[model samples]
Target: MIIKKTKTILATTMTSAMLLPSAVLGKEDGRRVLEEVIVTAQKRAQSLQEIPMSVSAISGDMATDAAIVDTTDLVQYTPNVKFTAANPAYSSTSIRGFGTPPLAQNLEPSVGLVIDGVSYGRSTFTNDAVFDLERLEVLRGPQGTLFGKNTVAGVLNFTTAAPSFDLSGYINVAEESLDGKRYEAALGFPIIDDVLAARISWRKRDKSFGLYNTTRNNEEEQFKDESMRLKLDWFPFEGGEINLLAFKSDFESVGNGMQHSHITPSGFQVYREADPQTEDDEFNNTRATNAPTFTSRFSEAIALKMSVDTGDNWVFRNASLTAIASRAQVDTPYLLDSDFGPVNALSLETDGPDRYKQEQFELRYTADSDVLFGWGDSVDWVIGMFVGESHATVTQFARQNLTGLAQLAPLIAEGRGVPNAGAAEVAALNALIGAVPNGEQDVFAVNYVRVFAESYALFAQADWHLSSSLTTSLGIRLGKETKDGANGSFANTPVPALVAGQENFDNEGSKKEYEVSPKLAVSWSPSDELTVFGNIAKGFKSGGYSG
Candidate 1:
């Protein structure tokens, strides 16, 4: 009965955490329903209700107080959009199940991220703090015709709120059981006239620990973590904007928990512990022994955009962007619980962990009317040149059987002036590199986010009106890509190798094909509030290994 109840509680907790990102709506015309959404998949705004794509758009207002912490939150609500929270610091995510498990930073994202018009790379960049987010637009289908590389899978675009001409701000605070807290605040005041304005925001999540009941003997039998972000916005002109945002965070959770610390057969309750005396004083004995995991991350980005109307039929837009980011860690991790405690605790050492950075610039000209061209009464076109450069580094560490319980048990026992230590217990405490393995890795890559060659890209597109109710469009993009990586293959790893050899492993491999995906779409509106549209697109994921 106790085991059943525990399982039920865990399921319930997970369900609630997954759904907290959603909300209930007020009674609407005698019907209760989810909110309608708007999206900008093609680099232009459009009502999601009118688009045929299966997209999820979490608006500014909805995103603010929701449980959706970062890009990973989308997995709970979207169908076929799955992700594995491989670790608190890293995750593998996909749309339409298109992404292969990620292996290297150079292996391009199956799904891309765009923030304030700048592309965000894969790697630690995935952990960039969320803040001052005005809106998060997730385009679920292929967006190849509009967005360049990686759009073959889809895109996640984040637009920060622009500075308000008026002075206003708000703060949010929340607390949860098992000891948890989160505080976020943003304030925007004019730094200049309406033509120029500035805004800033900050967010933080202090260290909060979780309790691990009597289980696999562990010197450190608890976990806690922290994260934060800061953002700045500057609008120097009515039609042009500049944004500078920076974020940093560190997370250290001692005992990241095991699947089963004390699972007994059938109806029995077993007694297993790492020496209750030591764990009971975990917090009080904070000279910092047995903190199994340590992680840290830092990221910053700058973007500038300028848009000016040349005439009634034409507009010109120019943008420049730069970003730098990294994630590093050394973890004493355990694997595969044997229904009692960790079956294998491995010591992992990592350094200069992973880094990805880029600088980009773009120039695009768009027109809404046919007045500039003599071919038709209604037509539009977008031709642009984009230049981008990036350099990155990735490192993976070696793992060795490691545990701190026996070592700490003796210490706590000795501290209490125990009469003597058992011969078996004394022999259980030692290894090279402190029961850990050391590893080294280095890789450099230059990839383009838009408009040109290796580590860069350039492209153009166009549209035409066949008649008042029917329209046609065509787009073409040409680019280059590079990916390079070397890691201890999952095949060479004892655990994964055994799992792969015995279990049905379905993870896909890398896609080396240079992609060329095009799209075709149509829209017909018969009523003021309704439109019917359909589209067909070819999309692909850059495949690779994952460990």
Candidate 2:
């Protein structure tokens, strides 16, 4: 009996307004006291309750308890956030129902990701491991006024824990039943009594816990990951500090356990008549494939961050200046079966090494509760300038087995009113196409893409406290982006007639775009427990080339 059941599943992304940690409420001598949750959603540190926008702050301890290991896990905890991934290179994140589709190599991410005050130019880096973090903050709605371009949806901000003056360390290990194991460790110590400190964290994970592949007689969806981060802090002067951060990660996966969820009657008939490896296809944890498939990626990054306080001596009182410079790169190579079946139909692989590199620099000034343009001590202001450049190279090649296509040659012959066009003719045709029916791989097509991009931006924000219970904020950003792209496609088959009508082409183009984003917000706090806030913000995304 085939039992078909249908049910609606509503996934509600809960807002954290009322879901703040219970630790926020405390009782002392029959009096209610609230502990503040601090956040830097606006590029400045402030109480979460005082921010005039939607934000969710999750501490590292809470993340550990929730088993949030990577950016994908964050969707379950943050409201209006969604994540999907076929692989690390094809992960997509959405906020407020806005997100780029997976494998959209031509478009930038709708939601931006920033770590330790450094913005990652590409979304592919979102799959890196999350460890030893101080806090994770999700800022909802358009954040382009503060985060610059590519934040039309929202932003995910990660802050790693700073090295402590006191020596401290911790280790965590876990194991599962399906040959899964994870190890994480962190250490922090003072290199010099009061001048320097260092902290380091490392993690390793191996998992083989997915569907079984009957064709290969092995487990599918197996992966291994390793990551490490190191931080150093140096106090150069009374109110100046310098920080160095380095990070590295390696990840590899074997199989994805992909299978068709639905099929039409005619399609099923053709699939079965040709070479159907499995008969069941209804949410089954089994896949049938006879191809070598694997994906691997290695990433490295280094950043230098410096901050200095003016100490009430400059034009702005109680102001601080911060600067950051960062460099990052990701190298990924992968191969996969395009036809997910037992038949050696087709495969896709990288023609050579694939790489993406980014360099960024930013300088900002922040004044806390200081007078701005003679506005008294109720206005806090921030201004920053950012410059970035990136380069990406992606090359793809397709290999095909003519036997899979030859399986349908007889049907085509019959349809054309040709009587008794036997298998011998099909074999000859395959040979003429520079392929064989004996499951030999032949180059079918190759596509190469190269992109270089540069962007410069200036952003500023000011919050004015009209009264003890009312505040207004205004922010704006002006940016310009330039991109140069080159693309080449070639049909590499020997016989033009057998390979259809595909032509080789080479294209190159350059473009420049300018954007202006502005934001205005107002917040009213009637009491410590009651607050109302609203904002109107403009967003922008730069243009790009299609792969």
Candidate 3:
């Protein structure tokens, strides 16, 4: 009996492996060299030691060369993946801690992104634009019976650079004495010599930093980015094939707002100190600061692919993609202002100010080795279909200061809307804690994303020839999630809707969910370099709740 096994689940993306296949154990003189690394993770084409699972592949020239320019250098080469840039326009990622609360678009990200093959609703462009790849496949577990749900926590695929019938591409430069500079270029030949081929690329970078300014002068600010990509291929006759991809990017920055804790006076210590006005609350002094911030972003994407190769065995494929993204920010923060400088002053506030844009589309399909199985010759299976839509808009505003004007006399004779009292005195600073209103409400606007019903799944894997040195195989999947949403079309108002009969005001109109995902494997090759494996899986993420 031949059997291989593996178990993967680490919350998502390059985290433990999504779109996976990771196995690299070393020993040179002691003799041991393992390198199988091949996976579509069961969509066919196996050899990650014949599939047990836990995948991680990387190389966009080590993710944008010259000392790694993006994706936080891909979290130390993927191992439990976690990130918190919080600035440079916010960043959030986690795997194993199973996260979703990074710049919340109503919280939705357990990890499932695919670039190049297109499928990334929002990972803030996986740490904002910067990838020129040939590999980046991380697939962990729970893929909703073959990628139907939001992947519970797995999937991060990006496969670029494909256009070379015989012609190369490369150009790189670097600089970082603290003024970080980088430039990259690529080009591939053959336009129509053998049915057509093309490739084009470009990238740029600039960065500068130093925040606790000791006259490091440019004091925390500077990082510019630019990008471009293009690829095309057609073999017009050879069983048929076509591929096209595109990309664009622009990112700008001038940082600030990365400070945590220290408003002293509570048993304060910088080597001993208690009350006595505690030196007027000194934010742990570091040359105290104020004002200087800005962030901006713009992105683009396009993809098209077609496949057919009926020379025998079996094959067919289809893909379509699209994207347009936008982001904006404005910041002017200076904290610890216990009224004014002595220890905490310079308040020039601007916060969570917002602006975001989005556009997306998807269509996919693939099939190989149509199995009617005799249970030998290593059977295979794969199927697909998907669609998408999105939109977002947000706004924020704030202002207040008439020097508290004697605490506004009984909240202005109890005549105006109290609580941070307003009506001219610099105006409603806390509008009763919903925050000062300048009115332009339409936050979290996601008009629609209806796919209704078009989900079909069927998968199978077998290789029961487990003798001659073990090789067991297995696979299973079932799915459904026809999409639904309606919080009364967006907006559920009721400050006092039911009358005196309050019991949580029941009249429900939008809430329901269902899903099922499964997978299991076992493998043992034992020769041609050697092998062993293990895997167990289940992944699905689709539930709704937003207001």
Residues 1-547 of candidate 1 have per-residue lDDT tens digits of 0000000000000111111123346577898654545456556555555444555656667666566555566445556676555554455557766653554334556677676566655534554435666766666666655566665567777666657768978888877554556666777777675655556666665544444433333444343444444444555555444555544445555444332322233112111133222222334422112224444444455555555545553242232222222222222122212122222233343434455556666666665654235554565666666555555444444343324333333443454666564334445433222433453111111111111113334555555665654455556655555443323323223332221232222232222225454656555545544545556665434333333
The TM-score ranking, best first, is 2, 1, 3
Error of 2 at 56 (Å): 0.8
Better model by lDDT: candidate 1 vs candidate 2? 2
RMSD of 2: 7.0
Winner by TM-score: 2
Which of the numbered candidates is closest to the native, going by highest lDDT?
A: 2
- List runs of model 3 lying over 4 Å from the truth: 1-37, 43-67, 72-102, 110-135, 138-143, 151-154, 157-378, 381-512, 516-541, 544-547
Q: Cα deviation in Å at residue 459, candidate 1?
A: 2.2
Per-candidate Cα lDDT values, in order, are: 0.47, 0.78, 0.48
Candidate 3 lDDT:
0.48
CA lDDT, candidate 2, residue 499: 56
What is the C-alpha lDDT profile of model 3 across 1-547, one tens digit per residue?
1011122343312212222334455577898755456555545455554555566666565565536666767767887767555543455566555656764543346677666555555566664335456666676655555554566667666666778878898887888765778887878889888888898888888877543422223455466778787888887886566777766676766554243244443212321221122232324322223234456556666666666643333232222122222222222122122222222112322234333333333333333342234443333334444444343332221122222322332334344545543444323322322432334221211121211222334443344444544555454555443333322122122211221121221122332344445555555556654445565666656554332
Model 1 ranges off by over 4 Å: 1-38, 46-52, 65-67, 70-80, 102-106, 123-129, 212-241, 249-252, 259-291, 312-345, 371-377, 399-453, 483-515, 540-547
Candidate 2: tens digits of C-alpha lDDT, residues 105-223: 54668889898889997777775537887788888877888898888888988888889999998899988666889898999999998999999999898998577776777776789
Q: Could you tell me the lDDT of residue 217 within candidate 3?
A: 30
